[model samples]
Target: MDEVSPEETPSQKVPPWLFRAILTGAVALGGLYVLGWLIAELKMLIVIVLVSFFLSFALEPAVNRMERLGIRRGVGTGIMFLALLAAVGLFLWAIGTVLADQIGDFADDAPGYINDIEDWLEDTFDIEVDAQGLLDEFQEGGAVANLATRLADNLINLGATVLQVLFQILTIALFTFYLVAEGPKLRRNICSLLPAERQRQVLSIWNLAIDKTGGYIYSRLILAVISFLAHWLVFWLVGAPFPVPMAMWVGLISQFVPVIGTYIAGALPVIIGLLDQPSTGLAMLIAIVVYQQVENYLLQPKVTAHTMEIHVTVAFGSVIVGSLLLGAVGAVLALPAAATIQAFLASYLERHEVVQELEDAEAAQHPEREPLGDRLRQMLDRVFTPK
Candidate 1:
């Protein structure tokens, strides 16, 4: 061995206790890694169960209604499930028809549309666009053509995705059927594991979650319908093709998606109108603005506050975090999750009655405090910190 120099050695030896702690931490970290790997492997299964949870809560009311009308609970659950399936099938058919029509129309008029766009550019901006030449270049085995070819090849992957979706749907349906049919029994079994007092709390949270989830889902549907009607009327008045489906798309997207959903939903129709004829997109834009004003100022806050009972800031923040976590699914789930937690906290958590009570208590030891305006401003500043 080489001779040890003073500077070459560690300043101090690690203690036996610290060594044991480090070893324990390393083992705990490895265990966490294994657990995470297992979770990833079961991601789809977990998602199906969670999705079933949401559906069970959302549909409990309808099933109960059917049961109240002299139907058995199991029978009522089955009927509701069938009705849900039918509705989904109908929606898919409508979307497929719209897609077919749009694709066919676009394919047929693509050349004329390109030429018209070029003409518009030349007339409006006094700048000639070689759109026709560009189109020709794209069709002649250039990079754009290769990209298109690749996209066409990738279309086959849709079949695999469809199969996976079908499997998930069947799994969720099976789970939901059992959940709705045996919800009371399931709750009882779950509550049996807890103390009597804790059971009451669990059941209370369960019922409240169901109410909030059902109300939220129904409210979104009603809002979607209203948006669809506005979109359809505006588009039909302007003689847009496939107005109904396009409007349906706008309504659903705007209602379900958070924050920028309205703009995204409105953009599609405007683009279609702009492509179809001049000034039509402007009329569509006007309709979107008017409807949004009516919805935001009048409809949304009332319906949402009635059901959601969440702060506006919290709602926005939840949507953003949810979207960041799980894309579209998180966005849809975010509001209900936040509402559930808010309700639970309101029910159980004790809140301070006074503003700055801690500061006030600490200030009692001091001789004098700041002026009221300064104190108020300071409190407000702390509450509303800048991003």
Candidate 2:
């Protein structure tokens, strides 16, 4: 017989389990991929629903009170919604009027401002600046024409974007209205599907969520109103133009937007005051700094301690994480979300009293009596030493 080549020999039979294992893995991977794709597609809808849920939680207490007073839930929700709309409309109207007037005034005074700037430069630095020449060069470069052309080209896209935004707003409104109006029914339906123990637990969690979310929002609103009044008084005293709108801007931004909001809110009034009169600007700046300090030390702690009960560091970290995950909307919702989670965890999780030694170590002592390094070392020893 001819010598058989290695290639011609029959291959060993594949293991049945190995084949099944590989097939199962492939199916599992495909399923995960499809799930991820679906989640990505529905991300916006999920966000909208979350927003609606939070709005409902914030409005539930008010609606409940109205219901107890013999008003229908639907009617109460409608009334609340209309009041909110009216407040927002008034704010927009005030801001718009101020902005329109300012823009017109600025346009008319443009040449005078340019001349003043040129004179200041020449007097202070001996630099002869040609403001008109720069403007002429800019116009000559056809930048204005190009900008106009781009705006014209993108007009249709802008309109489409506006329409899309309006649709989303409508969707949010409808969902929020239903959630608030039918809240009791919704809770009952959810509880019906659960066992008695689970139903109790779920209802407890739902009530906790409403308390935390509503408390957070109402506290912020109170702080915002206080801030607005404080700033408004300062602006009026300093003779700042558009004081009401500017104060409102400061209050809303500083309360809602974290981190950089105070600076941004303070900037407009300061700039406008400087343009009007340097003394006014200086006074406004001083007032802003003073008010910020007061708010930080006095106002915020007192208000938030009762309502939010969230640590500053935890709140800041939550905002950062939320912004990273979902942008501005995430940041706005983070505080209430964090408060709810914190309240739930606090209620559910067990706690133990601190040992005497640990409590004593944590207690503040005079640095003169105990050196800082020694105290730290003692604390570390106490923590790491064996029982």
List ranges where model 1 is wrong by over 4 Å: 1-27, 123-128, 137-156, 355-387
Model 2: ten consecutive residues of lowest lDDT: 136-145
Report the number of the highest-lDDT candidate.
Answer: 2
lDDT, model 1, position 129 = 86
Write one digit per residue (lDDT tens) for candidate 1, span 186-258: 9999999999999999999998889888888888888899888888888899887678878887888898778
Error of 1 at 58 (Å): 0.6
Q: lDDT tens digits, residues 1-387, model 2? A: 999998999998898799899999999999999999998999899889988998999999999999999999999999999988898888889878877887667655666787889999999999999888645533534454256677889999999999999999999999999999999899999999999999999999999989999998888889999999999998998898888998998888888787668898888778877877899989989998999999999999999888888888998999998888778878888888999889999999999999998767766552336788999999999999999
RMSD, every candidate, angstroms: 9.8, 8.3
Candidate 2: stretches off by over 4 Å: 1-24, 137-153, 364-387
Per-candidate clashes, comma-separated: 0, 0
